[model samples]
Target: MKKQLFISIAAFGILLSTGCTKLNETVLDESSAGGLTDKQAAESMIVPVYATLPNLFTHTNYFALNEISTDEAILPYRGGTDWGDNGIYIAMHTHNYTSTDPNLRNTWNLIFQGISRSLTAITTLPGINDASAKTFLAEARAMRAYYSMLTLDMFGLIFVKEDPTALSEIKRGSEAYDYILNEFLAAEPDLSSDVTHGRMSKQAVWGLLARLYLNAAVYKNLYAGQFTFAGEDMDKVIEYCDKVINSGRYELSPEYFAIFNDNNDTNKEIVFAVDQRADLNGHNRMAYFSLSGDQFPLPEFVGANGTDGPAITPDYYRTWENAYAPEDPKVDPRFYKENLSIYSNANDTCVPAANFYINRGILRGQQYGLIRRNGVFLKCANGNMLVGKLFHDTRNRPTLPVDFTEKVDFSVEGSNYPSGYRVEKYEFSRKSASGRNFGEANIVIVRLADIYLMRAEAKLRKSGDAAGALADVNLVRASRTARTPAPPALSNMDLDLLFRERGFELYWEMLRRSDMIRFGKYEGTWTEKTDANPQKRIFPIPQTAIDAASNLPGYLVQNPGY
Candidate 1:
């Protein structure tokens, strides 16, 4: 894993900085001095690949990919919210957004790195003689399928160079979908069915295929306008979903929060995740990115140095609570967790909760009646910590067992201050991490919860079998929550209901954008945003991509609305 990590990053740096002209025809770099003969050495390279998967799901990235893509969600317009203007640009192009930025290039590069590393493995893994070599390469191909799905989903193209020999002739555009599809189908047999969470298995491959075909209409279209799912594709979607279900390796975790509560990496629902391994002696993690205290957390989760980033919007929370069918009692338990601070910055005080929380607010606000021993609560007039969960980020850490709560405060005063809610889904770990770096986190990419929802969509579309879809959807809903009036009915019976259910179930998980697009809602209206154009469905091919292939003339024209 370590070798995989080093090679993936090193190769990525080389690919990003060097254009195609200076670099070899192919973008893979296997020159890593790491010996691949032994399992120990071979696994190092795999580590980087897995390690980097989490990078694409960070606040900075997910915001661009998820929330910004949906009208059901929005950026706070706060002074520092990133507001994800890049996604807004596409949203605006769709007529749902008006903001803009050039830095979305960063997102472009990060995903591309995933692509490059997968390519490197696909091209190089076959040369090894180890008994497990084929298994590893199959994993590599699965990664390629994963990223290629992203590329096809986002850019409508593939790099098309699995083999070093096919390097020079590689092309991009909607034309690349065929190759991407073939790659995934080819690799499915090699994946295992052992039911590993966050590890690509045969079931996961099926999920990818399900997702791809579900959106086949959009990918294969000549002009993207109100794209609709085709019958054949929808059938395939159902086929694959059933394959995943019949495998019997995974089932929805009874508790949504438990899936990510701590050590969620083992959850049966998780098909893939970022292995946030922290270096105890080196850099403190999960704490650095999500922690608030500057005194502990490797002394990095404080002051201007910390990310102190994005929070759940009040509007989004409302959607979760209101989107349910009222007749069904079980909704997502995570919904209640949506906008609260699950970790104390450093002072150990509970984080705040409110429509727009800033800091040190209440754990449950006035909504649930839960609170701290001090009778601390949300101030409605001030919107301070009125709707939140204040736990301790430093409750665990390997380095010093240091109390991150002692070093900071979790309260806020104004502006975009949580809008009264902090996302507790990725809580600060009590122990820093594997190596005590405080950077460790349990990643939840394709959890069982997600598969349930994906299958619901497929089944619903396949036969207007919202009854079947409703069952699957409600299964997830029933697992996570308890509610007043017996919760809501599983309305997978209605397309609109099913669509909204997805947004409510998958909020902030990086799947929202694609889900919205699949449901034909990407260009829909949000609280304060809207997509204006059709071409914006897919992102503008990064400007750098054009320059790299500019010599080929018409080789890489940008997607419209650039």
Candidate 2:
């Protein structure tokens, strides 16, 4: 089932790059899709619904809006030229973004595109009489719920339509939240329990339900003082998480990095993921985005310059540093401590002379990597890759020692560009012949580790089961300790401790914004952000969407803050 979706993604990417998707074209040819056999029609109808996923989860879309907006990452203008698209990134981090931000507008449109496609499938797929027809219908509805939930979570509104030509009504707050929850519930019965991880299976539905229930209070009231996790909601979260856990289909990955590798489809830890492939339409942006122009990861490909876009915040980095003993920071397996060295030969075969190949987790301190000079890679006397000091893209800037630091000077113009550390959470693809342009790494959307964490959190919040919560947390910690030294186990648990534990386990996974809001820290001042307006809890509906919806009477409403 997943292979079929992968094939669709490959075909979709080719057509998408050529500007031939129905969302871009003049019209949808229902005859071609409708005239197919039952099996063929089912596949055709589901393509559009899955097609919008790449645009939604790609580096610049959902990941940028969610992670960069939080303290986990930031995309400052390197050398005051690159990544300086009218300060949109800064606006996101600072919470000053308006409805006119182009990136924000793009995300808004892409999400609706998914919702629109899903709605089309819900009405079209039910007409087939094949055995797969019911499963396809349920999957379509589940897709709609998934997309709608994201729209609601981010914009505080969802669009509802009865059929392809029907009008859409804007649902808000608890109304929109409840509608999405019920949609998932309605689809659960018919959803295939044994579908591939990438498809909408009963497990995926349960994971989505657990997530929705976990954040029920926040969705019920957009901005509230001290959210109360309703007992029933918390219980539901536990129940659904248990359902996923007890299924025995997933287990904690012994290697933390294995969960995000290119071969992660067979890792057995991922419950839901975006099936990206190098030969198909996979992305190298996640691992390549933050690297400097001088660093090269692959020996087979050249001229692969990273965008130097997003970097980890010092505040988040301090959390990891402060948790462990300073003498040996790499003792914790999640930190990827063994390979890092303050010095490098620069002539080594590794992409980054610093030996960052296949390494995962946060990066800090002096970085060693091959430096590009005079439009060619600098080489050592023995024909080994020479280590040259990195300099700003701007001419005559001070030479960089490849030293990554925690503090970044976001306001410096053209200088101090390489001050922040780069994230290597996703495995760098050494097999791609296209270098950083394409990759084969599968991006895990949800995994067993997350399910365990959610259940542990629910147990702690619903009942004072600190011991039970600690056991779950330890399970995750122990699973990753097979190759690296394990941290001492905690005797007790608290909300603050649990929150920090989540930072260690789930950073850079696009969960920071929601987590911060649930923890009541979203409004608090951090780094570049201020004004903490309660109205900023949910982004303003894009002005473009609002203007387009104005064609129909009372069809759309802008969010509270623009």
| Candidate closest to the true structure, highest lDDT | 2
Error of 2 at 446 (Å): 1.0
Q: Candidates' TM-scores?
A: 0.72, 0.89
| Candidate 2 positional error at 378, Å | 4.7
Q: What digit string (tens of lDDT, one per residue) describes model 1 on residues 1-562?
A: 5455456546554433221111111222335334434543334334444434555655555445555455533333332342434444334223432213343556667777876666676655565455555666777787777877777777666666646555434444445666667877887777667634545678778877877787777778724666766778878877887887777777676656556543565566666565543321112233333323211212112221223333443445556546554622123354543332333232323322322222221112322212222323334354433323333222222122112211111122222222333334444444443322333455566666666777777777667786888888777777654222223455436777877677666665667667767667665554444444556666666667676777788656666566
Report how far off residue 230 is in candidate 1 (Å): 2.5
| CA RMSD per model (angstroms) | 9.8, 5.0
Question: In model 2, what is the error at residue 460, expressed in angstroms?
Answer: 1.5
Q: Rate the local accuracy (lDDT) of all candidates.
A: 0.52, 0.74
Clashing pairs in 2: 79-414, 278-440, 353-369, 354-368
